[model samples]
Target chain A: MLYTPHLTTRKIMPEMQEFPMLSLSSRITPEHLFYIRNHFPYPIIDMRTWGLQINGLVNRPLYLRYHDLLQMHQVSIPVTLECAGEKRALFVPKTRGEQWELGASSHAVWTGVRLMDILKAACILPNAMEVTFEGMDKGVRTDMQGIFTYMRSLPIKEALNPDLLIALYMNGKPLPFRHGYPARLIVPGWYGMASVKWLQRITIIDQPFKGPFQAVDYVYVNTAKPVETIRLNSTIAQPSDQQVLAKGEHLLLGTAISGDSPVLFVEVSFDNGMTWQPASWLDPHESYSWRRWCLKWTATNSGTYDISVRATDAAGNVQPEIADWNEKGYGYNAIQKIRVYVD
Target chain B: MLYTPHLTTRKIMPEMQEFPMLSLSSRITPEHLFYIRNHFPYPIIDMRTWGLQINGLVNRPLYLRYHDLLQMHQVSIPVTLECAGEKRALFVPKTRGEQWELGASSHAVWTGVRLMDILKAACILPNAMEVTFEGMDKGVRTDMQGIFTYMRSLPIKEALNPDLLIALYMNGKPLPFRHGYPARLIVPGWYGMASVKWLQRITIIDQPFKGPFQAVDYVYVNTAKPVETIRLNSTIAQPSDQQVLAKGEHLLLGTAISGDSPVLFVEVSFDNGMTWQPASWLDPHESYSWRRWCLKWTATNSGTYDISVRATDAAGNVQPEIADWNEKGYGYNAIQKIRVYVD
Candidate 1:
């Protein structure tokens, strides 16, 4: 089915577009408005001939048609997928890559068969250490020679997690071409990069995967470790930076999310953090989805005010005042500061 | 002479306004456009009754009229005065303060009597260790009870610096009321906080002065030291962040400044600092004023580009990729990053 894209384009060649956060009022984002992060143009696919191949270090090397996965038991869940370099432009040194602001993130309910069920049927070998997923998209990287396909790997234990799914549908509809048509791997609670789209092959390997996307691009250059869980973060949707408003009551809006835990609270500061007041949660707490929040603010004085917001997760992760800098500019989750004027 | 204020008001109570940097073309800012950093409302003064009292540790107590200062030899020099809180909003942890961006700075040629000459006339005693300058503006601070006047002190050595001036004229005209009317202290090479405005008293002390502006404010909270010299910095004036443009040659404009030393070079990075190219200097180097620089860039691809700028001083101080985080958010001279799009 064809649909009009609702994302704001940041890049044209590879077609990278981000969701408009100001338009978000619901926990589940519309499928069309879901942010699109692509490394290459959508790979042409003939759904009639498509098949999923599960091989390497397994008892049964199975090649099953797309219809076979639909026949298996399915699970549905709402998950937030945020780009690893979501706020790359805000980094101090400005790392090289897509200069995404705070929009390269979105949430949606996905429905598909659990990967654990499929992996059990394949009968993984005892020596297997990782599961590598490969997509059909190919591209030339300036850092490396020759054309290469997008690929990534996850630990054996993580691959078998109950929440991991080979998603076939998004928001109760067949996945669109831009988001991977026949099937895609959905690794919840992790960055979008870990969930390989346009997925065609899965290999259970005996050792770690060394593909550039897995070992180089997605890894924090300063620490040489792959970025995993999402950091505790909050974004202000109202009274944007340098916005002028009338001196009276105003509603402040934002969203907070974490990867492994639910948000405990979100705080808003009007006096440059001298004091913080709790913001009311607008949405029910969900383990894998962002919670919308709002605060009623009254500005009696006419002047410029510095407004800041911070969030804390149930796992004791408080949004930092300053995130650690990385060369790739991944995972910047510092408290948000927006300066506005009351006139 | 009445002139229209060309500044952008940041605060209206204490009358704080900032220069519109995009309107800057010359090294010296117009008197009406120079940024104003005030702690309190402008104090009313009668020229017939106004006198500068120089006493305390001096062997001779002297009160000089405004004309008395004009009788002394006058020295003129261009100086750049930057607020300590400039760029406070850019701090990662989100500092508490005015939330000033890059506009809280300006350059001007000041004509006045040398502060050293005035001190010589006052005859400093051997016990003098520090010299304090006090302003007439008074206000009540939330951090401290009761009323307090804006005051700051300089070391005896720095007080004797030949470059320091009792400025009476700014940009070839009598100092405007918004800027310090009759006479003001100009602490060259130091942050603007040290330059007491509406000068009414000067005291030489045997030890350090512990006024709030000296002991508490105008300090790096993390270091507990008074912020002094300005940091090497640069600001982009053209093709602002998130600005969209046609895919063609465009001129990138900006200014670089330093306190004690001249800016040696300014570099622009197109590939997230992987490589940097030198920008052509447009203004001649001045000891205490910002120099304008520009680069002609051609965007061949239709995509977002992360353009960054960094300035290096002759003193070997290079702008940092990440400035050290401070509670008061002083001295943030990190390299600037502006994302622009070509379509």
Candidate 2:
């Protein structure tokens, strides 16, 4: 293990031990600490030889040197980079695997050259609808498993969002090596995995990149059905589970986002899965991003009760009770159930 | 200085260094990543010798040891812990002091006991409108300066919120020595200063505590001649200042919170003090907590434009163009203005 600082150990306060919490913001200082999940040793990139390649469904398969790319137009965007499995801490039965208890997500002010600028330079064909990002880091699994290249894809529209950029700086400084340095993707408001670090290549295609990383790995399918379908899920960040409440009113708070659609309404339940109440939501105009929501919960009854919350998106999709089981945990948006006692 | 990792230097590719950017998340990790603004160093706390004293305007002045306090009703709350000067990075030249650049906030699942439960244990009396918190940290600025003790007070209503907790654990573990071992106030969604670490005493008063920290420091006053009154202001977390933009449509995002009032609307302007548009808002219920907002803009014209965003509270309070100045940088919510250039 690397020389983990005392701060990293101190970061996990006793009050937060039960759940895995990942800092989501990118303004990393003493207060905005970083919890890193490294699959392999940190890679060192020599800027002298580093270059970016754009190929596949483009008019020109160009190999631009790093200096040449910098000569192009530069753009900065303030976007939220979240981990797709942010609320993995709320998972009950303590699912086995890379034990990630919250703290896997963060937001950042990414400054970089926009990918759209590069695509426009390459003259993207109208038939291109999928964009794939390949990173320099190699995926490491079990000993028997061969090392595979790490990559993920996004819809061309999302890839073309002016907010999306090839990030180079973090919090007004150069990107940390542990984070994707030199250049990485800044897909605001999406899961961390979607923002590929150690970026090497960008490919445009007509269809989704149904590779092992996207198809068998991160994708989730229901356990009960013959047809594999993705399940919607949401989580509550405030008013944590098993919390003891005073005999008064309080605010139940957290954020919700959907993979397939935009969040329309979020409902909170003070009594397990019984009576439900509506939570006030912040509108984002776009349906793909996450929405923050809160509900006024008055603790009239002074006793132990389970507080549960679920969310529905504009596509008439509500968070399910259980997420479909997959080889790799992805799309685990189930009904988040928390226990709280009122005194 | 501590072992500030040279992670960014070696890892960043040379091609990506031209743009300066920062991540949106305040803290990236729990320990070394989170910023600690201590009025004083770590206090040596002995649970056996440590005791909590609750007095003033109450039916009974109760003195309880750590063990005794633990035996009392326990409460846990998942709240976002923010520092008053979180966005110091965005502070313009006229408002530079403590110089904290956006690394002064965090959120955690805090678990422990409630102060209200103890107050209920010691029968409450009428006329209790304010509750004051005192810590063990003491300091004297330079030499010969008067000794100042860190103390703050909250409204009786805010103190009694079921979400408020006397946290003993963070992220679900014992408190670290640096982070007020034994006990501390977890005022979810408020600035970190409000959640005084190294808690020592609690006192109920008939009126708000008018101390230096409360009345003089951390308080914002207008900068106008014969300055008008002090009020709430707005802030953006993503775009600090001088960020680059691509020549296309992009979303401008950040979070804002009003003191003691719910944010009614957030407006964004791209042409420096000219026309403004409403930014999308999230969860408008908790006036005391922060709200995230975003606005979409098309950068068809390629030039540097001053992007300014202001927020209005439900009480009809709007962020000013020129925030009132003070000795310390409190309430520096001058209509936050940033410069972004389109190709």
Candidate 3:
């Protein structure tokens, strides 16, 4: 197993861990450091017997072995996956969940065959309106009856996106045991919940999937609407909150990302939102990946300052001043506020 | 004026500001860097006409010049003053006020004559029940009908504490304009609110004083009882929240303080409160002033950690796991929890 002692473990039963935002200084997160989110304990998978099953609404029912998929055309791309509940602890009134602060998201290179490529081989029928992906992991839920597998669905239009991948490799290395050893799904531009791990079967359906994860858990409690695409967000990586520094030049660094489009630009405010200045981009704009930005701040005087950062995506979505708070605490994309003292 | 550009500004009219927690590493905070909490605009004072008035229930009402009090027995001691509303923003229900995070407190050397010494010379009448301190600054209150000066009171028994002073100097220098010029009352061991500034009068009352500041604002909203002594509290000064450090031997530092007694010991927890280890004291035990503490933390593995610190006072009061929730958010003495990442 790769060295992964750095991830912060939020739960031990289902094995949920988070990536540290300070590690965002690196363009692509190391596979071992990438966050892991699971619904149930790791399912015992025998590589020799593991197979990918594709059926329902398809002319050809295909069940291919792991070696058979490895022989298919493989594509590698960098993508960012953010948990819907990232920054859930920041919500007022206290939401229920893992209470992740701001590290429930990470970026990495995923390599695998495009799910569309597999669907084309299966010859999807015209009547397929949505496709459901189910993981082998199953457990009993207090809110539901009997045992249920971790399952989620995507609309046919989203499912057909060529960017969606049946990922087999992370950061150019075989998937680690804790991060779905055999295989996992990678739905770019969407929350991590859509990328089901411990992949087992895919079925095309004529209607939306209403499993507990898709219907009750991940949905915004106030609206009862399922969360999907990642929201525009930015977080400071330098001058950690309440840090003190000597009066001098300091680099204010942070990262920004959006699922819909590349971050167009980032702006920072030092006077509590009174004035904003453009920050220099550290990394070239890349779709489906976090963009690092920084500003050279020279402190001529000593004082405590509430530094804030906001990002605007190419699609014109700017991080809001105050996020629309929901009971489940999904999609918290408010401007990042960090307080620092310079002496 | 000593150069003080480091204080964080919370309001402008009355000039409320906070000293950064990172600057707490030093035992004695500089006069200019000390937090400034004011209710009304600074009241202009002419040193020539300024005189402390001792009247009401006193047997011999007396008006003494500043120089006259200076000639009396004078003493200097280091004391820490914390605003009752410090960490008010951490309240879950969200209280209504300045919304100070944690910088609204600091330590300074105060030099002045004891309030008990003045009360003795003035011959307080046996019927005196309380002492009312009134500041020169005045403003119209939305809750009240007419203009009102900032005022508060202390029971006669507590008012006689020899440590309480009508301070004239801070950090070995005459009080600065913003701190309170000429003279100000310093009720050691009490919240900063009771240490009335811009002192203009001291009236010994025959009954409990019911000024707005005493009976309305500083009191807990749910209980309606006034907040008095500072709560036992501790704060991490190093490895600030979300800070990323290289994996190695590092020193964890922090400061703890209490109003009732000196901090007896401090403990650090790295395993999320499961087990705690003692932290070495960096400063000699000093009552009414913060005690600095540090621990050697060697990180053998890279991982995200929720480092927590808790302090126990000599009076046998230990910091609580969770502070009692109050509407106004006063006396937040919960154990300090800070998250950091090691890579």
Best-fitting candidate, scored by TM-score? 3
**What's the distance in Å from true for residue B277, model 1?**
0.7
Predicted candidate 1 versus true structure: per-residue lDDT over A128-224, tens digit per residue: 9999999988887645567889999999999999999999999999987777768889998898999889889999999999998988788888888
Residue B288, candidate 1: alpha-carbon lDDT: 74
Model 1 - which docking category?
A: incorrect
- Pairs in steric clash, model 3: A6-B303, A302-B5, A302-B6, A303-B5, A303-B6
The C-alpha stretches of model 2 lying farther than 4 A from their native spots are: A1-37, A56-59, A65-71, A75-78, A89-94, A124-131, A143-145, A154-163, A169-174, A188-190, A204-212, A221-232, A282-289, B1-343
Question: What is the per-candidate TM-score for chain B?
Answer: 0.96, 0.74, 0.96
Error at B138, model 2, angstroms: 15
The sequence of per-residue lDDT tens digits that candidate 3 reaches over residues B1-343 is: 1111255545544566767565565878887667788887677788889998988998888897988888988899788899998887666655555657667888888999899999999999999999999888888653456788999999999999999998989988988767777888998889999998888899998888888888877887777777999889998877556555566798898888888887889999998899999999888887688888999999877777889999988789899998768865788888888776665
State the DockQ, from 0 to 1, for candidate 3: 0.02
Q: Give the lDDT ranking, best first.
A: 1, 3, 2
- Return the DockQ of model 2: 0.01
For all candidates, state DockQ relative to the true structure.
0.01, 0.01, 0.02
After the best TM-score superposition of candidate 1, give how far the Cα of residue B135 lies from its true spot, in angstroms: 0.5
Considering just the first chain, candidate 1 attains a TM-score of: 0.96
On residues B1-343, what C-alpha lDDT tens digit does candidate 1 reach at each position? 0112235445554666667666666778887678888888678899989999999989888898998988989999888899988887688867656657668999899999999998999899999999999999998774556889999999999999999999999998998877897899998778899888999999999999999898888788888877999888999977666655666699998898888678999999999999999999999987777889999998877877989999988888889999879866899999998887675
